[model samples]
Target chain A: MVDHVGLLSAFGLIDAGYRQAVQVMEEGGLDGSTSDPDFLVATGSEELRADIPVLRHDGKLNPNGRHMAQQPIELILLKQWASYLALPVWLIDDSGNLLYYNEPAEALLGVRFEEAGEINADQLAEHFHTTRLDGKPYPNAELPIVVALVGRVPSHDTVRVRGLDGVWRILAITAFPVEGQGGRHLGAVAMFWETHDS
Target chain B: MKVTLWGTRGSLASGGPDTVQYGGDTAAVELRGPAGEFVVLDAGSGIRPIGEQTPSGTKRVDILLTHLHMDHIQGLGFFSPLFDPEIEVHVWGPGSTTLGLRERLTRYLSPPLFPVMLRDLPDVTLHEIRPPASFALGSLTVRAELITHPGPTMGYRIESPECVLAYLPDHEPALGVAEFPDVPDWTSGFELAHGVDVLIHDAQYTDDEYKSRVGWGHSTFDHALAFAALASVKQLVTFHHDPGHSDEMLDRAMAEMSESHDLEFELVPGRVGLTTCVD
Candidate 1:
């Protein structure tokens, strides 16, 4: 339950890194900064259709995967790290709220968190119908993300998750637990890629 | 009854001189009843030869598919019977929870992946058949039992008055012991193959290969041997040959397994043209 406080900004590391990402995104789509790895934030900058909300009421822009008190230094860096990359990144608090995601993920979710307001995991699960690569559904409890939470271990699963567009894209999802402060559990993070996108 | 191994290769169809002896065609097996009835086990690349040599009398081709994996259904569009106006192919297979056999087949058989759609194949009629059930599809009494696979895969037991032949082209017996937690132990493999005239079981992996690939839905030769022994099958034809295994590799495997085990039944290597009398 211990979320390491201000590890990134206290060192002026990810704060500078993240703001630079937003700046690059604002300039143009992902193509603007080919030199920088995080330039992918630029790809969907025009589409989110709203500013990154300053909703500090619960310290989350949206009720993402889960809710919790603080963001571990790893999760903080994770948030910044996800903000730049091209693949879809999703982070949850210990309480299971959707905390942060990059622009590439915004395109897949159908509703960008910026304009759509705060949405919880329950809401996001609605957009996805999880199944195997051949379109066979696993019992919800046995799904890879759920299994990681139960096992407290990192897990990789390959399944097709359909977004709101009703297009079932085969995604390889990797889910891992976030640990901080003498190995206290914070939450989980997942990075997913549409297999066919390659 | 007569059983012919049209294609014995698993996963993918690999061709070359290396695989020519056992054949590189994927999953199709031709079963002929003494009544001159025709039944095809799967539609793997092996079905191509079937299309070319198919007899004219039986216009209705009974294709009992185990599951709709690409390797199992890859040769569907290329099959010659589908192009003929008079021939009717009755395709039978298991469906996903929501999708019927038609919907599942149409997923791959239609445009983008293939130029022809299921609707265009007017002669082919798809039927959804759930296992833990039995049905008659001619003189043959067909019993479908679900197997330990990654999906809703069924290993069939085709019985005639003369004898019974069980076919499990792709199965993971060890997985039956550990997975499917919601269900009780899966003994379908044993139930289907037990005391049967012939058992065409999946022998895609070696003992070492099975260790790392536990849930891959295919069995090692050792596991297949042990299973066949326990079930007391009269004849064991190790089917679903791994694509990477050359003919020499298969011969070595057959010899190795034969010499290694003092078994009750004869262990035979499944070759493309190999035919066994189901008596």
Candidate 2:
């Protein structure tokens, strides 16, 4: 009989409990030769590893790692492009918690995320509202992360909250939903462009 | 050489007990240079006293005016020199908006405003001025610039070998478009008056009064300071005092004028017969 569960374990797909199943499959093999099922399972694991890349310390893919890792060339290019364009880019989860922010975002907003483990978007908006020169409420509907989480795609040139050193600044915001592995919706990535008024 | 004011009133001359102390005559000043050469700035109601002071003779007179404002031109008919045929008075002023200089003077000197026409005046010639121009008479070089006033008015920068004096009697600092971009820093008149010995500027209102009377073609003392400081003048004589101001009020205003930055210029309120040597 073909032991599908044991084949998946040898390919590093199953959990630790599947180790006995893999031993039983090896004993059943008459000449201890690799079968078509085992070969198919190994090939599937290689393909899966190739499709999802692991991030390195420098935010690029580690090519020399033992695990099959795909290069995050597109993500690295996006970060570089965002910085070059002078746009603030940030990733936020469904609960409106900031997950990641690019260099431009730190420069424009004047917020350092080096020591920050978690950031609440609503709290940040509230703080911006109180400190802004115009002294107006920041509407949630106008926030890019808010719109993206609610499954509503915002139009281009939408203004977002931006205040720096007692001066009011205008920002254009856009958001896109990010889908991770297993078709899971990770959250949204928001891009901001600050416009200065002379 | 000496320059003495006989009248400094503007608009309609208001003569009353309150105005009598300052001699409520309309704009007139007598400038006497060396070799007996003399000129008058304006002929307002103040010309009566100036006429009384003129020695009885056939001496020629020169009269220069900024405009035909009633207070500026009214004294022409009353001046004693125009009555003498041998006096040879030469009257100069800014050209009229719709009429020539002669015609404009004629309209005022004719029947409606006065009994005599300008043409009938004996030996008096009216010359229209092309301002932002300069002319020389004896030892004095009189330069006129287009100043901001109700009609076209000219601010004069009279230079003698001894000293330079700038006279902007009816200036409105906020009038017209300020050619330069910055407010409180740039002034067209200040550029024309840089480094003068004395600046006689219009101080027609206090800061409080100026708020209600803005665009009335006059300036306050604060506006005067901005220009005077920029010009680096030695002495700033505040003139064109508002008719409503009292002697006590003027004293207070003069006291507060020193609160400005150390520009090393003396601030003095203008009064009739207040004489100072130009040099």
Candidate 3:
């Protein structure tokens, strides 16, 4: 073990130079720098959320096949269907974990689905800061999406949520449970559209 | 601790004259602890031979499956102990949200696919394991974690009194990474493999082949070497040989790879019936 550790430290110097050479070649030998003005502006700005993880804004790697491989086929299809629809849609698994939300939904959520990544049911409920129309904190169990997820039933309601940008919006949401051919409850889908600002 | 590779061929089992050197069988491995504890990893077609070799005195055997890929579990029905009423068989595997291990295994083990049902095998127990699960098998301590694979796959860390071994037969740590081998803590199977005595990892594709096969749940040799270096593993057993690669091609590939990279650790090509001991 001691010998291996010693060898690892010695190899670090060679490995670093090797990787740098590979990177230089991969970047077309341009010194690994970008001269794009848009990139410079994006990096120079302060509006970019410092807390958010870096995502490839182009949505190329967002929700790739590997990320969806373990999900039920029904849920996978629903995610695909949501991706094409202009309406905002949120897909949650049987455990009510937030699997994904479409681009339109991303706009309303004030964060890209890639940026938020996958959040558990509990964390998601808290992340959205959902409340009833009466200005009271809404129980997660009673929320339309959670109700659909838990009961395998359709649910609809109007609720207020604080987006990631700290803007509160009143939205109308309809959620329905998704079931596969063998009576397996795959997951639930929630479609929402903004009605007004809260 | 003794680690034996019963199978190394990936994707499919291709037994022919060309593959005799590497032994064409899908992923099945046996790890024996010093205290007579027996553990089998995967039930690929290679497991048929392992079942034929099982000692009669062995009362219990545990099979830890990484995932339910057909290539990984196709030999479950052929495993001899599952049919023996005297021997206890325990199968552990990852489960998805809608289905548990038993339910998932039932899909392949029942009816039209196979003549017998999973339940028909007396004394066979199926345990649904979630990642980050730890358990003890006699003298061996095993830890399982979800890895970057297409399905609900797991990589295992087996620690015996004498040594530690990591098995990640199918993985793609560079799937979405801008740059791979970023850090030991950030890599997929690094946690299980870090500083282990032996790291049996996926090296099913050449870097050229991997260019077109990204996100296919396997690693290139370059990625494997980088990962081994980052983890500081003492011995790296390059596993999961591509079914298309014959002995000659594999030898040429390895020779080229050796010339290109400055390796710091012992590199061994995984092969059937090859046993390495840690004491």
Candidate 4:
């Protein structure tokens, strides 16, 4: 099993630039400020006016840039840890669209990353509605990722998902809803696990 | 109101010396309502004897099944009343995914499984219980709650003018505990069984056995005791003894269960031919 704590630590490293920007805003007397980017642009506050963009080398962010501020180093380390963990994770919107998925998710769902790219959470929910396997209709209320995005916290339970191989596999899907400032719904993070394998 | 144990064996029926004392019949319970109205719990093997004893007449036998576990419905094939042209039997149970109650029962009672088909049986009506609901038979009121089990099993509460008896002979408390977090607060089953006169519950496993078979659709004697205490029931009869337990083992279990709970309720190990009056 991949160490979850180590994986989280790696996430912190990979998103270091984003993390530092947030920290700067928090410490630069911008705490509790709800000014939009347009408003900030117009105001031209001296602190906010100082824009810093990390330079990139090829596809990766350059670690040794004057404006990089140690964030890129942390980001690279976090990405390395996350990739090593091989976690089955995905990002979905409130309307149940698949926004992003990791490599492990592809293996768990038994679909090619390219093929799964064409499908989304809404399509999956629709498929569940019309499909009948093992002589039982798929329970709509029991769908984990959908329930999470729709803000319905289901009790901890396992749901059966049919794989491409025509074998039914139980999956433990946990949804964590993401909320922004003023509790504005951002999206949701979903984690899937094979029941027996877990 | 007389409640008779037509069948008391849990799981499968055992006919040898080991089960002779408690009676080897599986899951059938007959409740005689006011004016001698018959309310059969399950049609397990015990129903064979009940069918033999119930006089052949144009009387309607009301059969209420908790679920369609083989041991619970196996005796339907041998229920002699179905063959009697004068008798009209009403079978009520939960519906399966694809079939209604009658259809599901017929699947088991028909050709390949049985020599006699259900459609060919004389004067039988089947009702499928879909949601949690109630019904009235004469003056008695029957209420059912969908319980947590592998299949769609239900716990029934029968109320009359004089007494209230709650029968939940096949339930696993942990399943309920998992669904409703406030289960320990005595909310769900207690609300239905509150102040009942007699609470006959599923006590299939001891506390030790429950640890291994947590979600296997059976409850321990401790869980039953706690429920009876929460419901403030007058008497608690532990039904559905694990097939492995002998008469002597059950006696020891009852004794161990009574030591921890300080209540003025009678704790009895249910036996065949045992009769109790509700009123």
- Maximum-DockQ candidate: 3
Candidate 1 ranges beyond 4 A from true positions: A1-198, B176-186
Error of 1 at A183 (Å): 45
Residue A181, model 4: lDDT of 21
Error of 2 at B123 (Å): 0.7
lDDT scores of the candidates, listed in order: 0.71, 0.61, 0.75, 0.63
Task: Please give the ranking of all candidate structures by lDDT, highest first, separated by commas.
Answer: 3, 1, 4, 2
Show model 2 residue runs off by greater than 4 Å. A1-198, B176-186, B259-263, B277-279
Question: What is candidate 2's lDDT per residue for A1-198, written digit by digit as tens?
Answer: 124233323333334543444446447652123333211112113333343233122242211222322112122223333435556787665445554476677765566655543355544544453212254554434345544543324444445354534445666667876542212344567887776642
lDDT of 3 by residue, B1-279 (tens): 998998899989999988887779999998889998888999999898889999988899999999999889998999999999889998988777567677899999999999999989999987766555567779887777677778788888888868989999998877766577653433577667777889999999988899899879899989898988887888889889999999889888778777888888888878788887557
Q: What does candidate 3's lDDT look like per residue over A66-177, in tens digits?
A: 2222333345446656877899999876655667788899977787876776655555644677889889977655668755654456899999888777888899999998
Between the candidate structures 3 and 4, which one is better when assessed by lDDT? 3
Question: In candidate 1, residue A91 scores what lDDT?
Answer: 78
Q: Which 10-residue span in candidate 1 chain A carries the lowest summed lDDT?
A: A38-47
lDDT of 4 at B233: 80
Off by over 4 Å in 4: A1-198, B56-58, B176-188
Q: Which ten residues in a row have the lowest lDDT in candidate 4 chain B?
A: B178-187
- Per-residue lDDT for B237-275 in model 4, tens only? 888878888888887888888887787788877888888
Candidates by TM-score, descending order: 3, 4, 1, 2
